[model samples]
Target chain A: MATMMNSTVFGTVVPHKNPTILRPLPCSLEELFCGKVKNYTHEKKIYDSSGKTFTVHKSTLQIYLKPGWKAGTKITFPKEGDVIPNIEPADLEIVIEEEPHPLFMRENNNLILRKNISLLQALVGFSFSVPYLDGSEFAVDVESLTFPLTPKVVQGKGYLSQRDGSAGNLVIFFNILWPKVLTEEQKSILKKGPLSECEYLGLL
Target chain B: MATMMNSTVFGTVVPHKNPTILRPLPCSLEELFCGKVKNYTHEKKIYDSSGKTFTVHKSTLQIYLKPGWKAGTKITFPKEGDVIPNIEPADLEIVIEEEPHPLFMRENNNLILRKNISLLQALVGFSFSVPYLDGSEFAVDVESLTFPLTPKVVQGKGYLSQRDGSAGNLVIFFNILWPKVLTEEQKSILKKGPLSECEYLGLL
Candidate 1:
């Protein structure tokens, strides 16, 4: 069978150098899902050996974002290139830049978020809610005796994969926060309690 | 001082899959040098699991080409891309595909052409004209005892480099073509002659 010709090019949407959040600034999740259009301007200057400058090309451009687009997702445009004389104008490829998200790290299609919890919660059990990429909140339940630095996974809650268009899991890593100082009474209580193993090692 | 934003997005003007010539078909060197605008159309389709296909997007676009544009040259279009929400639209980048030319080959900014010459021309001297990229013709002189498969260079007759904008040289390779058969009279006339070292080898 004859193959179809590719009429569009791919490009990356890069994130800012210092991104403060996982999502784009001033944009809501709903806006990203529904797609958005923006106006942009670009300029260049050519300098000679004598430092004489020439304004080469400058103009404003329109950037389009489709619904469900994310970092590393290629945005394509049709017939947005040079004229091929008699044939057709080539397509433009926009490779979405794989910029690091400030609050969330990406692995394949999965999203990773790290959170700190109290020592008590790590020993017993805890329940909490985290913000999903879609702006909705999802609850995370850590079972009793859940170890600090361990990861708990919430399946099917991650960024959409551009390769297969499937969603991935959201992994949460727990960091235990220990009290910096203990009162005399608290230290005495711990010493007489069931922490004898630690007391023998002078950790009490 | 604040830095200036890039307003122009660079894209490649890809060569044809089977490029017969350097310039695109139906395009003259004059037209390429003067710049031209041509109409183009693009289409795409979406298919379901049941093989139900639907046309997604179709549009006619205007493709612009500037003068002195060649294969591997980047063309820029200002403000031609998707619009970002509240922010400016992103610029589109076109990457020209490096395709093989049937008659001429490219290396960096230089051009290469190979031609075949008669055995007599390789032993004696010969001269000929070769076509330049800019539609001009230049003469090439081969000195006596020119070796086969050796290249003769013509300076300042190559593509303009996008980096430095300086021109390069054109290199020509010679291929010697031997006569298929010799008649008896021709063979006898050469047998009784005063033979040089090479002539003795030929006779043997």
Candidate 2:
């Protein structure tokens, strides 16, 4: 024998939630290289206590950005947008957008730097230094002859991954500056040298 | 005043049509450079005269591919797929896919060819020749010292536009081969000459 139980249930129908329009949050390379927390304050409509009336409410969304966050990174804040009569409140989406850097260009996780150097620097050794995105300077002593537009790779110097906490390589490209003309004496010296495949001097 | 008219209308309810799944058509660079016609034979179910029974029908789709057509190019055939009860047939979509070439690579409207040359050939003059995608050969009599990985652009030599009858450029890049060791005499000869910016000889 079982006893009879009565359960009364009442529920409100929920209309489809409104879609969120992407809002761009532009950040400089410096801010992307260093982690930061940003806060946004805006006004949105919310339901009053009577549930039929609407009132404006001020809300704030806090975003914690990690290092090396890239453009198109989306963060969704639930129920933070305006509320309509019978529909659920829309979500607020904040996407990260990068501004072009003065020194470095990012590809995936690698950082590329392009520079023009004199022919002397390409033949002999040269000291290379540049201020990094984090406002820190780095230097490399290049002992070998550099080729034009050839990348000199430095290990573990680029963007640090926010997910894996790992770093990528930094690539440096040098463009050679060729002299317009040579003197008579210079031409004679060049005409006298390296008869065979020895013209690529240093390696030979 | 216009004459009053009585028009009887007979209409049928239209159901939602089926969606199409894209079918990829692989093409060689040669075939893409030279226009070709491709035919595909397939079997599909269609309604019989009673409009209630299914019948298997064999059909063919002819594709006319033009020159310079790139990957992801789509061609749609209306109502060429299987038919179900009470709905229009799905459309057939054919997408172009590029096959890797043994000699040349395509970039937009341009063709790129990479080659490796000896150091002697780079210092002196060299003759360059390669078979193009259209089975035609091209030659260049390089009179200057060819720098490593420098590109020689030949205008109006690549893909011909099917729409406007225009053509693109052919870019040739050369990589230099360096000698592993040099004789003592060769090293001395290099050390004595070119103290100034005369090393980039022909230009300087």
Candidate 3:
């Protein structure tokens, strides 16, 4: 009888709004498992933290993205690990580490984006479009709004909550951009209209 | 500021002799995240321990897979998780669960297989071919062998070890098959040849 053990590996994949996700593996690695890969040589150049570089030779392997595969995804290759002399080889596992997105922020299946709008737009109404995590564009219409600090929400437009089958809402927060320098005419115009209420409150 | 939390999900990938690994996600899941998928509703049917079936439609999601995920793989769908009212969605992690292989067994980074041979072959000499994990054929030769219990080994033909970045060996064990019944003519033939040495032993 042979003792069974497992080996784990980590990997990362960034998901776009599209349904399909793609991951590439070294050709040498594929050859290591598949024995051969036609005519191609598997090789990769990598650098360490100290800027030391090395070359790795392996066949290329591609992992097709499936549903339920997201950041922190872990997969195991049974009996695909090391050899212990007379015993059996262990299992191999692959873990994933997703790179952070630039435009969107996540919070428990909810998507958030911070947008900047002119003071006039914040005071009146604003309409804009933002990209969803899935790569789709969503138009946000802010109606009957006077404050920019409050966030606008679109129901069923956020992330898909794995916990509940429903989609979360997409929230857009507006940051009112105030003029860095105001001309006398602009100040007078502001004071006569939007600023009139502040003046009346004696808090301007 | 949004509180950052990571949701870990486990998945499974069966390792073949090929380099590519594949995983599939449900179409409903994609629709749930994308906010629209035509007229089909997103509903999951699940069976409980008591053998009761139920339909779930709350948008709450849970991924269930036996065993555990390996290391070295990551998938991140930004803001594709829970909705915290006004906050962003949490990150979703899918851990992998590797299915076991049928023919070969593992131990660390080594691969093992067992084979059976006739008693005549065990006593004289035998040669055969076996499939490597990577789908390659390797010939094993046994010469000057009297015992049938010993194993044959191929160096550096096992699994790749992550600790040392080297491959292990492939092990083959032999099992001697015995005849259920012996005919008088066969017995006499055996007694005149290979059995001649036993006659020198007083115990025989």
List each candidate's DockQ score.
0.00, 0.12, 0.00
**lDDT of candidate 1 over A1-204, digit per residue (tens):** 111233333564322121111212233343444467755443334333343443355555566766556655544455443222222333444544444555677676677888776544544457988866566887888754445345888887765655777777888887655433344444444334322221121111
- Measured by TM-score, the strongest candidate is 2
lDDT of 2 at B148: 55
RMSD of each: 38.7, 14.6, 44.9
Question: Which residue runs of candidate 3 sit more than 4 Å off their true CA positions?
Answer: A1-69, A146-148, A198-204, B1-204
Off-target runs (Cα >4 Å) in candidate 2 are: A1-12, A41-43, A46-60, A193-204, B1-204
Worst 10 residues of 3 chain A by lDDT: A195-204
**Per-residue error at A49 for model 2, in Å?**
9.0
**TM-score of chain B as predicted in candidate 1:** 0.56
lDDT of 3 by residue, A172-195 (tens): 776655333343444344333322
Local lDDT at B116 for model 2 = 73
Model 3, span B51-126: residue lDDT tens:
3443353444344321111222233334443333323344544333333556566555566777776544544456
**How far is B84's C-alpha from truth in model 2 (Å)?**
45
**Candidate 1 positional error at B67, Å:** 80
Sequence-dependent TM-score of model 2: 0.51
Q: Interface RMSD, all models, one decimal each? A: 51.4, 6.6, 52.7
